[model samples]
Target: MVTITVTRKSQSFVAPSELTPSEMLELSAIDRVPGLRHTVRSLHVFRHKDAADRVASRPAEVIRAALSRALVDYRPFAGRFVGSVVAGETCVECTNDGAWFVEAVADCSLDDMNGLDYPLMVSEEELLPAPEEGVDPTSIPVMMQVTEFACGGFVVGLIAVHTLADGLGAAQFINAISELARGMDKPTVTPVWARGLIPNPPKLPLGPPPSFQSFGFGHFAMDVTSDRIAHVKAEYFQATGQYCSAFDVAIAKVWQARTRAVRYNPEVEVHVCFFANTRHLLTQVLPKDGGFYGNCFYPVTVTATAGDLAVAGLLDVIRMIRDGKARLPLEFAKWTSGDVKVDPYELTFEHNVLFVSDWTRLGFLEADYGWGAPSHIIPFTYADYMAVAVLGAPPVPKKGTRIMTQCVEEKHLMDFKDEMKALF
Candidate 1:
């Protein structure tokens, strides 16, 4: 097993400027979703191939200074999430309190950390910073950690209160920090808060998700190679008379295989829920300012029977997923205008539910902070059995797809792997 020991060096609250006043920003209805109230973390590891010696000397100071400047425009991150019960509904309060920053050192080289065979075994808590006990999490929506390794390379881990931003929004903030580190006067994209853009649902659903019998759980990585993706696209075109994206192909396959792996009863209902990006998808609905700095996508669910999914052809599954996504525009309109009556509670996870999200489009490798882009961007968080995170392949080949799934049974995990390889 690979082990890393991290020693805390310094801790502080970094504000954009000494004169920046404290203020409160309200969170959107999407941000206040039940499942999304917790913190979401991103782990970025940069290996300094040539300047390790120079970087090791002042890693903390460099990142801290950059972060302070980056917070100037993204001041909301330096605030807390305040909640109040208004007429039986939960409302969010965002108050500027300064983001928590921690500096640490690991007694290992970047090579040593990366050489582990089972990457998930490494302890995530030691790498990322979190809110201290007795301190309210909402008070510090953003927290960061800079860990210097013995080999001169370093790791940057960030945890943001989900109420503050989504994954893309978090990337924007990090990129801004990187821009400042590289001596840029300002970020490439301006930050904007538009939570009121989407109105709350008219009614909230009160119910627990369906239940399933206990079973084995495992995490597996599936590769969607360039050639394999091309083949799938071609097959989809032939069968459906249309082209589908790599994401469509990959998600359909996983959803199909998972139904079989878990031995879900043929008569049981199953759902594949997807998180779609509406930044560009709903150009007519969103303001022309471009993707705002908050949760912009909606969780859309598609339903089918386990037996149906198990037997359905790939093209059909692809279309099913694609068509479900295509309806988001009308859904968004209905949702914003109170025509739709749904709440986050209704989207809870269950045995028959499989959630799929695509992170491949986000440029995780491009946050260049003077020392070039990161070599590895790993999600050190554990996923439950009913979830799939679709990410782009490593920086090298740049043509394949990578996925990390949560909680599959031991035997089913192997079968899932084989199924994925067979699809390619």
Candidate 2:
């Protein structure tokens, strides 16, 4: 019922002039480091009829206006990763490849878009979380349409570079768009650009930012799905087991069992790195909802192998991850300009990624444009070994967990349901 009108446009999504000193420092860090111009992180979904109708009536002028305002108001651009130092986004668009646009492949039964990859796999064995008590199903981000098909189904998608913002960051952007549609003012909190988190690059500095090689092996760029993935989670608690969420408990037990099964060197700096937004550590604290909307999450990590962690208590694992998150503020040393050059590291991994993102709290489906909010949003559209999307689902008896996985070890993935039974 609400309407929004766009009245302004800016060349870059972010007005570099508005950046505070620290924010500039943060942005500067990105400039110093090289970025991966390709393989942007994006999410896509297919929409049904009524929703497509609502989108169809919406003019590109209004939508583009809304997007521009969203860019300025929320500035998803601010959180994006400029290309790598060696193979970064071209300083100019004409010189740049298709690096600026979010690239997604949607291939349904139809053949409209030149580069759309359809849903390759769908499974009935998996479960879905029930939509919250009263949320509309169509408003979900995964349900938005990139381009409506002649058959009436619509394709919608989201592209985010891991270095920029992760699932939480993308979710915040979607929610802001919804708020704009309702004519809401700028979010109460502005985004704290992480660039400032980096210390001033050395007087001369180590040239540009570190490239992918400086960190580790090559990066990941695949398309995964349920049909392609093999994963399973079960709800279980032993009479003597510790109290914890299913993820914490299961991972703990698995680690314990795995370590006992193998030998690991204690000297190794192995860790479990998960997200906990470090917005406050940035140069400036924007409004609570700065840039995007959602809870400020931080990456929680721990160092343990199959055996040690698997045998740990539930409360213990929770406490450990909590402590790891608290230490996030310590990482602000980059802002302080430590001796080590700033190198952004992505927590995602191939054949070994464990994402425990809670989408319900992300406010993704709550943000409605003109028509309504998205009913469902799912990650793990790429090919992979293990990936989990923790969002609300409707069919499971209790809250359900949707796991997506792809790997050479089909046995490890196909044994998911059995693993759930074992975890229980």
Candidate 3:
């Protein structure tokens, strides 16, 4: 194994290039969700083969300049989240503070680190930026680090508060930076900060936040070849005469394999939770040009007994997932009207729940800073047990799907692998 060491050369705040508005931006209920108050991190790796002259010579300077320009429009990211006057809620105070930026250098080349692929060779803390010890993360809306490798390759690490944007929204912000880095005068899509456009329920007192307990979870990644996915879809269609997407079939397979590998009691109830984008559902409120970049995705869950999921046919699981997805529009409506409330932090941590997110279509891999698109994009770390992310695999001859997970215990890791292999 190659030992990787990243040292920070400089750290500073990159403010907007132009003076921007200073106002408090009220967050939508979805944005103020207690569960999303934390920060999410990811890493985008670029190889030296496609590096352009300017970016290859001074990656940090180019990105920092681009970031300053990008913040002029996406100014909320340059602000901090503060407690709202309405108790139990938070809002973004657009003070035009700036985003925390770090310039770093790595001791090893991208090749030595396996092109910064799955099972990352270095610690996430070393690559990603974070608030200083004892400091609140909410104080900083965005944090980024650019680590240059000896091979002229580089890695861009980002830490953004979930309250600011969901996966797609964050991608839009990154794409804006890339556009500027490539010398575009302006972003293709204009940013919209109409947070009040999304109606919020009346403020009501709520119970204390739920306390969570840690589990002995281990992170794992598995490659499910494109051929295997196609084969399963074909088999399902032939048997049931129905169509299923790659996400539908892939997640169903993981849900089933994980349930079996955990060896849960036959009667125990288990849940598969995933967020569904609701931008289309809010067409009346959101812009038509697809510029409303905020937290627009809502969580949807499918529940069944452990035994049922373990023994259920792949087709049955796929149908269950599809059915759950079909409920997003209605569920989102209820959520908007305050008819229902979901406190994700209140979810049980007994390993009976699986949180799945699909990143293949989020466009993170499409972010280019003059050097070409990233070779690989991966979450810095899974938030908790049974947190599964379905991501696009690095460019390769086959180029399949990569399932990154922190689902099973160390003892059951081998069993989980065996179960996943049995399916393929």
lDDT to native, each model: 0.71, 0.38, 0.82
Ranking by lDDT: 3, 1, 2
lDDT (Cα, 0-100) at 203 in candidate 2 = 43
The candidate that achieves the highest TM-score relative to the unseen native structure: 3
Write down the TM-score of every candidate: 0.89, 0.54, 0.94
For model 3, what is the C-alpha lDDT against the true structure? 0.82
For candidate 3, what is the total of clashing residue pairs?
Answer: 0
lDDT of 3 by residue, 198-266 (tens): 767655556564546566777778888889899988988998898888889878988888889988999
In terms of lDDT, which candidate is stronger, 2 or 3?
Answer: 3
| Candidate 2 deviant stretches above 4 angstroms | 1-65, 72-145, 149-153, 163-166, 181-270, 280-289, 292-300, 310-320, 330-360, 381-400, 405-408, 415-417
Which candidate comes out best when scored by lDDT?
3
Q: Where does candidate 3 have its weakest 10-residue lDDT segment?
A: 341-350
- Candidate 2, 89: how far from true, in Å? 11
Candidate 3 pairs with clashing backbones? none
lDDT (0-100) at residue 224 of candidate 1? 64
CA RMSD, predictions in order: 3.1, 11.6, 2.2
Candidate 1 per-residue C-alpha lDDT over 31-59 given as tens digits, one digit per residue, 9 for 90 to 100: 76656666666677777656553444466
